[model samples]
Structure formats: structure tokens, C-alpha cells
Target chain A: MHRNPSRPLSPHLTIWKWGPHMLVSILHRVTGVGVGIAGAAALVWWLLAASEGATAYATFLEWATWEWALLIWIPLSWGLIQHTLSGLRHMVMDIGAGYELSTNKTWANITVVASVLLTVLLWLYIFYGRG
Target chain B: MSMEIPLGRVRGLGAAGEGAEHWWQERLTSIAAFLLLVWLAVSLLRLPGLDHRTVASWLADPFAAVPMLLFVGVAFWHLKLGLQVVVEDYVHDDGSKLFWILLINFASILGAAFALFAVLKIAFAGSAE
Candidate 1:
């Protein structure tokens, strides 16, 4: 596979001076892909639990309680949070809210901060509060 | 009343109304998704090492089953819309962009449909022999 030297490469994330809208936009794509993978994993677990009988079900159980599940869920929760918040931002833009640069930055900050806060709260509920 | 503007003069490659359509559907879906996520988080946390029967029973509830399906469908559709824009923005080739946009929508639809069908069948199916 010969690399095409003539074709210009896209700008790298690190090189760009990040703005709020740009940051949120990048995070949205990242989280969307992450959530898609998580969705697939959930689907697999669901199908296995449904069709396979008690033994396979127990296998899922083992995985669900392990640290691995926490590892997965924390990021997945954050991903979902980010995706949802960013999605709301897009929806607001569609309706013409936050079209002003000031409002746009405010909402973008809200999206990122809210997603992080939600993720922390989720973890607290799952670990400290529940168990 | 003043004479209406001429169609040709006014139209200017008129909008497909995608803005309103996507905006409305996305908002509706986001609301559905938020509610569903609450249930989902609680339900998953509440699961005490679910045996097959317990898992099946929870999903069998019409309230849970229906919303779960709707959430997945809406979530995927919203995802497709968002990703389509990203792909369109970044992918410079017109043919490639069109191909990807179509592919993304098709894949999400199929995925959402399959998941919905599977869940519904399990939810409503006659008792397993």
C-alpha cells in the first residue's frame, strides 16, 4: 500500500487551538463510537443471558461483578453522558439557541462539566452508596 | 394581499426540511433516551447476578420492553445522524461521503431493528416449552 504523498493530511487534534464548540464536537464523536461498542457488548450479554441457560448466565454474572465490569461501565457511563450532553448541544443549535458565540461557549462548557459530574455521581451511587 | 414571490426566484435549492425533522426527532429521542437510561442504570445495578429466568422476566414487562426498544432505536438513529454529519464534514470525497452516510444509516437501522425484534420476541413470546 503506497502512501499518497500528494494528498494533504487532515489537521491533528493536538495542533489545533481548541475552542468550546470544537472540543465538544470532538468529544461527541469519540463518545459516539465508544457507546456503539458498549452497545454491542450489551447486546452480546443480553443474547447470551437469554438463550444460553443457567450456566452461561452465571458466566455473565461473574463478569458483571468483576473489576472489569467497573472498568467498562465507568468509561461507558461517561461516554453515554458525553454523547447525550453533546447531542443536546447539537439539538439546541438546530433550534437556534446558543448561536451567539457567548452562549455557544457557555453551553459547551455546560456539556463537558455536566458529563463529568454525572459520571462521578454514577460511580458514587454504584460503589459507595449501593454497595 | 401582495403578490406572492415566484417559485423559481424564491426556491434557491430549497431545504429538504432536514433541520426541523432531525431536530424534532432528536429532541424526542433524547427525552426517551434520558428516561430509558435512568431505568437502565437502576435495573442493571439492581440485577443480583441474574439467572436466565430473572433476566427474561424483567425484559418481559411491557413497560420495560417497549421503552427499551424505543430507546435503542432512537439512540441509534440519533447516533447515525450525528456521525453522518461528522463523516460528511471530514470525508472530502463526495462519492465516499455518500456511500458512508448511506452505510451508517443502513447499519444503524438494521441493528436497531434486529435488537428490537429480539427483545420483543422474548418479551411477548408464548412460554418456552
Candidate 2:
């Protein structure tokens, strides 16, 4: 891990022009934290409530289904969808393919578009199809 | 060719030799989570309802209980792996990074254990209707 003071520096995010790949990379981390905290906490809360008997379960549904809760729920669902899709892109890169600039950008854009689209579809099913 | 000195080359490791195993486990858990999450979504969609009685009884079934356990376990495992990397990237101080990594591991275990307990309680006891 020794470093020479005069050695050339490696390229970094600040040096490169931003692209979808960068966007997706940053988003992968952001959405990962978002989902890991908010989504998992919510799921844990739901399960705990469910196990706490009928009244507790009803209380959870009341709060969770409230319109205001969409503030947390919408972003959470989007985060989960986005993270899942972007993680797939990471998997592709982990295998060492998709490094070509055009190929990388294409997959990155596709991951973004598909995640948003899938999140909408998921909500639609929840609201309408389930009703 | 790697620019390692002969002895270092023979040893075949970078400064942190533990990385490859971490990388592999992360991917393995990610794959498991992907499959399990999909199965969970589809099964939930097919459920009769999400009411207490309905969902509880569904969970009580072995078919539903087993996969639920696996899904919860793998999701938390993947979360721990990913969270550790995030901590390493941001927390530069050795002490803080160690603290955060330990916190991440503990939180993941607690989350998964809480979830497993809830699922098991329903599987064994909550089916009383």
C-alpha cells in the first residue's frame, strides 16, 4: 500500500464526465441504503405486528395503509426495485463484461428505466388488481 | 502478468486476502435473495388475502413457512455483505469502520432473527383461529 508522492493519480468520478453508469453506480448505493433501512425496517415492523395478535395487526394495517404513509412506502418500493435491477447490472459487470462504454451505458440506462417501470407496475397491481 | 515480486507472487494474494471470499458470498446471497424474493412476491399475490387469519394460516403451512424463512435469512445476509462494503468505503477511521461493520453485522442478525421469530410464532401458534 505504499504510495509515491509524485505518482500519477488514478481517474475518479470527479474527473470523468458523468454518465448513466455513474448515475446507476451512485444510485445503487443510495437505493441500497434506502431499502436496507426503510424497507427492511418496515417489513420487520409488519411481521412483528402480525405476531402480536389481532389488535396489533389491525393497528399496523391502519398506519401502513394511511395515505400519508405513502411518503415512506412509495420511495421504499422504488428503492427496492431500483436496487434489485441495478444489482443485476453489477452482476453482469462482476463477470467482467459490459465494460465497453456503450455497452455499460446501455445497460445502466436499461436498469434505470426498467426499475421505474416495474415499480409503477407493482403499485398498479397493489392498488387496482388486488382490489 | 501481476507485478508481484517472486515470493509475493507465489503467495498469490493482495494486501487483503479475504476479499475474494467476501465477494463470492455476496454474489451467492444476492442470487438466492433474487429467487426467493420473486417467489415470495408471486406467492403473496396468489394468497387469498392479507388479513390476519388468512396470512397467519398461510404461514402456518410448511410449504409457506420454509421459503419464508430462507428468504428472510438470505435477504438479511445480502444486506450485511452490502452494508459492510458501504461502511468500508465511507468510514475511513479504522475504529469507526470496525464499529460500523460490527453494527451492520449485529443489526442484520437482529433483523433476521426478529423476522424468523415472527414467522415461526405464526407457523406454530398463530394459526389458532
Candidate 3:
């Protein structure tokens, strides 16, 4: 790809407002690409499972039980939550909403907060009991 | 006389009308993709080191099957959208831009459908043997 020196420079993170919706859009793309990488890793795991015997698969099973895996899982879950919410925001914008400055900001705030909360609840479900 | 524009030619074009349509569809599918993506991620995490049978069982469940297919479809759509913008912006040559646009669209859709079909066959083929 040819880099265009003359094209307008995109807003730098340092100079940017770092508002909720803006942050959401940035993170959504980041996390979407992140998921794609993680999915590739999972695909490798699948291929390994297919070729290797059950014992090898069990080793992976043991790894899955670790707290460290949970640490990784939390961010992934958060990514999912953030991406899904941001996508919804984009869809709403597609249909025309939150165009007014105030409404846009409010919805953006909603998306950011909801995503984190959802991620937290997901971890709670995984780690703690329903009771 | 310099060719005078007909009323139809002037009025027919909406506000970058077709561009907007493409943009909206991209976004709509992206939303769908994101939801299905979450499902796929969570399901994969759950799988860990499941055997073929257990994995098949999970895939066989309609819950998993439906989302997997949806994820594939939506992912391709989103890819198509993103690539379209890239082609439009970067490839100024009309011939090359058109070629890339068509090529990428074809490849993405085919890849998505093939992936979905492969997963579905493994899930439903009824023979773990």
C-alpha cells in the first residue's frame, strides 16, 4: 500500500478527545482484529486435537482450568462485549440516531459502561455459582 | 451548444446515495457479526480439549450451529465492506480498482460459505467414525 504523505493526518490519540463513542469505535476495531488472531489460535488447537490422540487433548483441557486462562478470557469477553455494543451503535447510526451531539455522547457512554458491566457479569457467572 | 444537462441527470443522483447504502449494509452486518463473534468465542473457550464426539455434540446443537453459520456470513460481509473502502480509497486506477473489488468480494463470500459448509457437515454427518 502506498502511504499518502499529502492525505490529511488522522487524529492522534494524544490529541483526540477520548470520548466514549470515539473510544468505543477505536476499541471495537482493535478487539475485532484481536478476536481474529485468537480465532486463528483456536483453529490451530482444533487441528491439533484432530491429529493428536486423546492424551494430548487432555493436556490442553488441564491448561483450560487455570486461573491464567481466566485472565485471558476476561479481556476476550470484554472485547466481545465492547464490539457487540459498538456494532449496535453503528447500526443505529446507520438507521440515523444519535446524530445530535448530545444524544450521540449519551449513547456512547451507555455502550462503554454496558460493555464493561456485561464483561464483569460474564466472569461472575463463570467463576461464581448462580446460588 | 455545450451539452445541457437533462433534469433527470441532475436530480437522479441522491446524496452519494449508493455509497450510503453500502455503508449502512456494512454496519448492519457488522452488528450481526459482532454478536455471533461473541458466541463463537465463548463456545470455543468452553471447548478447551473436548474430544471429537463432545465437539460434534456441541456443534450439533442448533444453538451452536446457527451462530457459527451466522458468524461466517457476517464476517465475510464485514470484510467485504472494509475492503471496498480500501479499494475505493487507494486504487485510483479504474480498471485495477474494479478488478480488486470483484475479486475480494468473490473470495470472501466463497471462503465464508465453504467454512460454514465444512463445519455443518462435520456437525451433522452422523458418523463420528
Measured against the true two-chain complex, the DockQ scores of the candidates, in the order shown, are 0.26, 0.66, 0.16
What value does DockQ give for candidate 1?
A: 0.26
Best-performing candidate as measured by TM-score: 2
Query: Which residue segments of model 3 deviate by more than 4 Å?
Result: A1-16, A40-67, B1-22, B34-52, B61-67, B83-118, B127-129
TM-score: the better of candidates 1 and 2: 2
Tens digits of per-residue lDDT, candidate 1, A29-98, equal 8888778657654764665456455577678777777887788878888988898889878877877777
Model 2 lDDT tens row, A1-131: 79897987876746777789989999999999888877788878888888888899999989999999998988888888889899988998999988998999999999999989988898899889876
Backbone clashes, each candidate? 0, 0, 0
- Which residue ranges in model 2 land beyond 4 Å of their true spot? A1-14, B1-17
Residue-level error in angstroms, candidate 1, position A81:
0.7
Task: List runs of model 1 lying over 4 Å from the truth.
Answer: A1-16, A63-66, A100-102, B1-24, B45-51, B125-129
RMSD of each: 8.6, 4.9, 8.2
Q: What is the TM-score of chain A alone in each candidate?
A: 0.79, 0.87, 0.74
- Rank ordering of all candidates by DockQ, starting from the highest: 2, 1, 3
TM-score of each: 0.71, 0.88, 0.61
Interface C-alpha root-mean-square deviation, candidates in order: 2.9, 0.9, 4.6
- Considering lDDT, which of the candidate structures 1 and 2 is the better prediction for this target? 2
